[model samples]
Target chain A: MPYIKVQITRENVTSEQKLQIIQGATDLMVNILNKDPEATFVVIEEVDTDNWGVAGEQVTTLRKRQAEAKKLAEANKPK
Target chain B: MPYIKVQITRENVTSEQKLQIIQGATDLMVNILNKDPEATFVVIEEVDTDNWGVAGEQVTTLRKRQAEAKKLAEANKPK
Candidate 1:
């Protein structure tokens, strides 16, 4: 049996997407690892931005900074 | 920040149980890994038993077999 789990920093995911993930995970195991779907498990979870971070900064704050930097670079670009 | 995901072959898990898992994971990170709770993410997923297995047999079937074998051994014990 293979257990696969994916964690994304988003909320309100639709059931259809969850099903897609589950099927894709099962298919990967069967195709690559020769595992059977009846014994495969896929779990997708959504984590809040505040609870997800990198380099000692919350994801929410890091995302905002990234967006600002991108906008600034675009404004200074020659067109 | 650290993300911890748990996948268990069970369904209809109570909210309290999930909370305990989340808290336990966060505590582990903070205490052992030196990760901050504010940046820790814990997601507990409940998977169906039909999708879990061990030793090339479905977990459900394996458990049933184990239970039956245990009963048989008990019945054959010296009396």
Candidate 2:
């Protein structure tokens, strides 16, 4: 069985988007690996930013820093 | 970097349990695969039964059928 787990930050992802992800992953497995669609499983996981870590820092912290940097750059831009 | 994903049906899993799973998975990768714990990522995914399927049937449907069968068997048990 070709099982695919797609993980993304917990944003407001719609049900339609989840459906598309499941369908696309299943299609990829069937087309490339010659797997049966019935046997392929695709699970979409939405993780909270607080729980997802990158470079030893939580995504929540990283995203906040990015937002601040962007705001600073916009303020420095010539009007 | 080693990334491990653990998927389970949504069944009231607690925060402590999730932490344990993350630690256990990271330990496994470090002990067996010689991977650095700092570089290991463990993500726990809780999926609704409606989204999980087996044998072309949703887990929700299968679990209902199982519960019904169990109830029937218990009722028919010899006294």
Candidate 3:
């Protein structure tokens, strides 16, 4: 049995999108490892930004910082 | 940075239980790998019985079969 788990930052995902993720993961396991689809499990988890931090910063703050840095870089670029 | 995802068959888990899982995973990663608690991510997913299967049987069906088998074995056992 093969178990595949995907972790995503909290966001509203459409049911169709979830289906795609499930099918895609299952296909990869079956094709690459020759695992039986019936025995393969795919679980997707949507994590809160605060609970899913990186580099000691919450994702919400990290994205804000990234955006600000990008704006500054664009302003400093020569024409 | 360490990411831990827990997949459980769908059940009504209390908020406290979820917190335990999150904290436990984060603690393990930090203690074992020296990962920063702020940089570690833990997500728990409750999978539907239909979506989680084994040996070509869905979890719902598998559980039912297991219960039946246990009952039969108990009945057949000599006193």
Q: What is every candidate's C-alpha DockQ against the true complex, given to 2 decimals?
A: 0.08, 0.17, 0.15
lDDT of 3 by residue, B39-76 (tens): 99998878766555443345666788889999999999
lDDT by residue (tens digit), candidate 3, A34-67: 9998878776667887788888889989888889
Docking class of 3: incorrect
**lDDT ranking of the models:** 2, 3, 1
**Residue A4, candidate 1: C-alpha displacement in angstroms:** 0.8
Error of 3 at B73 (Å): 2.1
Among all windows of 10 consecutive residues in model 2 chain B, the one with the lowest summed lDDT is: B50-59
Give the lDDT of residue B65 in candidate 1.
85
Stretches of candidate 2 exceeding 4 Å from the true structure: A4-39, A42-79
Which scores better on DockQ, 1 or 2?
A: 2
Among these predicted structures, which one has the highest lDDT?
2
DockQ ranking, best first: 2, 3, 1
Rank by TM-score, highest first.
Answer: 2, 3, 1
Which regions of candidate 1 fall more than 4 Å away from where they truly are?
A11-16, B1-79
**What are the TM values for chain B, all candidates?**
0.76, 0.86, 0.78
- The TM-score of candidate 1 is 0.48
True contacts kept of each: 0.08, 0.19, 0.23
In angstroms, the error of model 1 at B2 is 21
